[model samples]
Target: MHEKTIAELAAALQAREVSSVELTEHYLRRIETLDDALNGYITVTAEQALEAARAADEARAQGRAGPLTGVPVAHKDIFCTEGVRTSCGSRMLDNFVAPYDAGVVERFKAAGCPVLGKTNMDEFAMGSSNETSYYGPVKNPWDTERVPGGSSGGSAAVVAARLAPGATGTDTGGSIRQPAALTGITGLKPTYGRVSRWGMVAFASSLDQGGPMARTAEDCALLLNVMAGFDRRDSTSLERPGEDFTTALDRPVKGLRVGLPKPFFGEGMAPAVARVLEEAIDHYRGLGVEFREVDLPNAGLAVPAYYVVAPAECSSNLARFDGVRYGYRCEDPRDLLDLYTRSRGEGFGAEVQRRIMVGTYALSAGYFDAYYLKAQKIRRLIADDFARAFQEVDVLLGPTTPDTAFRLGEKTDDPVSMYLSDIYTIAVNLAGLPGMSLPAGLADGLPVGMQLIGNYFDEARLLGMAHQYQMGTEWHRMAPGGFN
Candidate 1:
């Protein structure tokens, strides 16, 4: 049961081979026995999951089951689940309980998927490694001593370790794809505004977009069908009609044009990861796909620009967390100023504070034009570069991260080095493009992933291409030793 994909599980449920209650109990037991070492989940809602599963079983008995009925999944802690603790992996909101479900949560519940629990994440989705999470770092399932990439590391780890068939994740500059790359799973980040963000704790409003993570692209498609929809409450939500993300899964790749970014193939990429990506490209080539080299002239500036834009938005979004309202507060305050200062200082972790300070400084009166404005201009250049490249190619291909998963604590002390971990993925968010990472192969026993970027609203093509590649390789089928 643990080894099956969501589609397979759904098929079994339809066939009456197993009950939703049985499937739910199976995963709950796995969490109880294996999650201590991984620390992949912040809260496990076993009772709620069982109750949902029971309802699903009744629906199935009544012949009203949906495609995803009874499928169990975990939500990234950043998404609010009414009556459940949506901590966002921060001490600041450790005691916070949402009064309503996030738009993504409501959609999944409507689809009949059981909510497993909320997975751990970087504090307010601020870090590259899961080490910055308030509930301690999530360990990579492949090697316990290695780090799982963040801020969606917990979601990636849970899916990679088979703790859940699928999970929800947000990518504000590679949180979903980076972790998915390191952990050897399929993760997707839809075009900005393609998915609703209401009730999802803001990290950076412009960059934060929720998507799906799972062992295979097919599973990701199934999950995205429920997650992508417009919500009137979220101003950024796209008003496009609903889509069947899996519609193109079986599309032929013959004559498909794939663009390889010259910048991505240059320096900073590990030789092993590069070699694996080349092999994957060759596999695609054999399928009659044509590859061409393209240039993203401003790609080099993406990191600095993202740091500025993301943090600035984060500063504005997180301003609502002052002790006067909700979330954590100091036990005693001498004055109003003391209450705000102490509550935030004591509640937020070092990384969160670092980003907030950087963001606040960037948005400050004197530096706003010099820093923030310039960064936004550079962001436009990056988006324009992708726009130009897409005119010649159907999709862009590259390595997901510069390297495979690093050992835990290897880059923690050097913030610059840590930030560079996402060097390959940040530009996609800057451009609001649809992107995905699929397992390519293993290098030194750790997984390597190949990334695919598509034009705006081109997710079906991205998922279809990834699914085709997965059909020709066994990388997505490989699981961590003990977990399987």
Candidate 2:
């Protein structure tokens, strides 16, 4: 029962083969027994989860349950849950319990999905590795010595370990997809504005988008159906017509053209990782899918522009965390400046400070026009490159990360090496296109993922393609050895 996918669990619930309470307890016990080592959860709301499960059982009795009525899912700590500590992996918000639910949380509750708890993240969603998390790094279930790629590391780890069947994660420059690739799970980051960001603590507003993470693309589609919708509370939420991401999961991939960008497969990619990706493409070709050589001319520049633009936006978005607001404050204050400096310095972790400083420097008076403005212009070019490539193919494909999970502290001292891990994924965010990472194969006994990028608002098509492949292969069914 614990090893079942969310869709399988839903079927079990619909047939009364298992009660929501039983499912909830099954996971609660898993978390209690397994979480000590992974450190995936920051706050486990046992009482709240059981109460919601009981309510779901009552709804089932009344014949009013929805598709996800009895499912248990967790949120990345970045999303504000009414009474839970919505710490965005920062000590500043360590004591700050949100007074309201994030738009995503309300929707999940409205659909009768049980809230498990808040999962850990990189402080303010700032790092590629999970090491930036103040709560401590989340361990990769595959090799406990390796990191669960982050800033949504905790979400990826828990879902991989079966702490929850599915979970929510946010991606601002590969935060979600990279983790999914490393942790060997399926995760999606919808086109910007597809998911409401209201009540989701902001990191880089232009790049932040939340979506679902699960063991299979089909399950991801089911979760995305509920996750995506317009909300008046989120000024940036897309007002477009609703979509049913799962409707096309069984659609045939025959004749669909997949574009392989030249730069993505070029220099610096690991040989073992490259071979696995080639095998994946060959497998897709066996499915009758055609491939083309496409060039994203500006794809190679995503890192530099992302560094400038994301931080500039973050510097502005994070200004609200001063001592006076709802988060952590100085223990004592001599004056306003002292209070501000002490609170900020005491609360933020080292990587968070690094990004904040980098952002601040980029946005400073003389540098803004030179750095921030130039980066935004390059961003437009990056988006243009993707738009042009889509005209030549149905979806774009590539490796999700350069390598599998690295051991803890391997790249912590060198930030550039850490940032480069997102080389293949950051462009998707810069283009504001929907992207997903599916477990394609293994490299050196560690998971290697194949990333799919679809045209804007083409999440359904992407999921369909991923689902088709998952049906044809067993990669998605494989989990960390001891997790079962």
Candidate 3:
């Protein structure tokens, strides 16, 4: 039961071959037995899960079950789950239990899916690797000593290990796709505004978008069907017509035009990862797909521009967590100033503080024009580059990361190198385009992911392409040794 995909589990429930309770119990047991070493989940809502499962079973009997009825899933800790701790993997919110469900969580609940629990993430979704998670880093299932990519690492790790068939994740400059690539799973970052940000802890508001993570593209489409929609509550939500993401999975890729960004294939990629991506390109060519070199000349500016814009936005969004209203507070204060200083100093981790300071400096009165404004201009250039490239291709393809998973603690000291881990993925967010990562092959025994970048709101096409590739390959089906 734990080994099945979300679709398979739903089928079993509809056939009455297994009860929702049985499925829930199986996953709960897996989480209990295997999660200690991985530290993938920050919380486990066993009692709540059983109750939800019982309700799903009742709903099935009444003919009121939805498409995802009785399907259990995991939510990233950054999402608010009513009455469950939505700590965002930070000490500041360690004791903060949300009073409301995030928009994505609500949709899943409406679909009758039971929540497995919250998965750990980087402190406020700030790190490339999961090391910054206050709860502890989530270990990659493929190799325990290696790091799972962040800030969706926990969600990716659990899904990769078969602890959950699918999970929710947020992408802010490659949070979802990068980790999915490292863990050998599928993750999607929908076009900005396709999904609501309501109740999701803000991180670089302009770049953050919620999406799905799972073992396969077919599963991601199903999850996205529930996750994507307009919300009046979130001003950033787009009022676009709803889409059935899974509908495109059956489409053939006979003449799909895929663009390979020249910048993506340039210097810096590890030889092994490049080899795997080359093999993926060969596989796609065999599928009757045509590949062409497209220029995203300003793509080279993505990293620098993103570091400025993201932190600037994050600085503004995180300002709400002061010592006064909620979250962590100093036990005693010498004065109000001391309370504010001590509380924040103790609450935020080193990485979070580093970003906050950098953001504050960038947005400061004297530096605004010199730093933030210039970064925004560079951002426009990057987006224009994507716009020009799309005119000649149906989709853009590239390696999701420069390399496969590195050992934990390997790049923590060099923040610059750590930031570059997202070199291939950050530009998509800057352009507000939909991007996805699918397992391509292994490099040095570690999973490598090939990314697909789509035009705005063109996720269906990306899903279709991925599903087609999956049909002819076994990468997504291969599980880690002990996980089985």
Candidate 4:
């Protein structure tokens, strides 16, 4: 029961082959049995999940169930879940129970999906590896010794381990897609503002976009259909009409124009990843898709530019967590300054503190032009490069990460090495385009993912492209040993 994909589970539920409570209990049991090792979840709402499952059963009996009714889903802790502790994987908010549901959470609830719980993440979504999580790092299901890519690693872990059929993840510098690659699942980072950010704790306000993580492109489509939409409450939310992303899954891939960024194939990629990606490209070529080398010349600069832009924004967004209104407050302080300093110093983890400091430095008065301003110019150039490439190709393809998942603690001491893990992915976020990671194959016993990047608001085509590949192969269906 726990091994089923979301679409299969939804069908079984509608056909009355299984009750919602029973399905929910099966997953709750899996979490109970497996989560101690994975640490994928920060909070488990078994009681609420069962309650919601019961409600879903009632809805189904009355013939009012939607496609997602009674399906279980997990939220990244960054989203504010009313009445639940929305910790954001930071100690500062460990005790903070949100007063309302984030737009994504609310939409899933409206679709009758039971909330599995909030998953762990990097402290304030700061790190590439999940090790920086305040709750503790999320271990990849494929190999427990390795890190499950970041910020959204916990979300990916839960989905990969079959603890949840699908889960929500946010990408700021490849948080969602990277983990999906490492964990051997599918993840989509939608176009910026494609999903509402209202009530979601801001990471890089300009870079953070929420999307779905699941086993297959079909499941991601189902989840994305629920996640993307216009939200009046969010100033940045696009006002596009609701879309059914699943509708395009069966579209033919023949003659589809796929771009291969020259820099992507030129250098920096591990041999194992390159080998698998080449095989993946051949798979697409066999399907009659045309591939051409396109130049995203400024893509190589994305890392430096993103570090400047994201951290600068991180510094500003994280300023709200001071000891004044809520979150952690120091026990005793000589003055307001002491209170602020002490609370933040003690509450945030080392990585979060490091980023805040760097961000502050980048956004500082004199350095603004030299660092932040220059980085923005580079960001514009990266976006322009992608825009020009899109004019020639319907979508672009590349390695999701430079390589497969690294062992835990391997790159922790060297921040640059850790930062480079997202080298290929940072450009898409900077450009605010939709990108997805689907398993290409395994490398060194770990998953190697191939990324598909679509033009702005072209998420449906991206899903279709991936679905076409998934249909030809079983990579997405392969589960980690013992996880099933």
What TM-scores do the predictions have? 0.99, 0.99, 0.99, 0.99
> What is candidate 3's CA lDDT for residue 291?
98
For every model in order, what is the number of clashing pairs?
0, 0, 0, 0
lDDT of each: 0.95, 0.92, 0.94, 0.93
State which candidate has the highest lDDT: 1
Q: Ten-residue segment with the worst summed lDDT in candidate 4?
A: 127-136
Clash list (residue pairs), candidate 1 = none
Distance from true location, Cα of 240 in model 4, Å: 0.7
- Kindly report which residue pairs in candidate 2 clash with one another: none
lDDT of 2 by residue, 1-484 (tens): 9889999999999999999999999999999999999999999998999999999999999999999999999999999999888889999999999999999999999989898889988889998878988899999999999999999999999999999999999999998899999999999999999999999999999999999999999999999989999999888899989889998898999999999999999987888889989988988899999999999999989999999988888878888888897798988789999988889899898887788899999989899889999999999999999999999999999999998999999999999999999999999999899999999888877888889999999999999999999988999988888787
**Cα lDDT of model 4 by residue, 341-441, tens digit:** 99999989898888889999998989999999999999999999998998999999999999899999999999889999999899999999999999999
RMSD of each: 0.6, 0.8, 0.7, 0.7
Per lDDT, what order, best first?
1, 3, 4, 2
Candidate 1: regions farther than 4 A off: none
What candidate 3 gets wrong by more than 4 Å, as runs, is none
Model 2, residue 337: C-alpha shift (Å) = 0.7
Clashing pairs in 3: none
lDDT of 1 by residue, 149-192 (tens): 99999999999999999999999999999999999999999999
Report clash pairs, candidate 4: none
Error of 2 at 424 (Å): 0.6
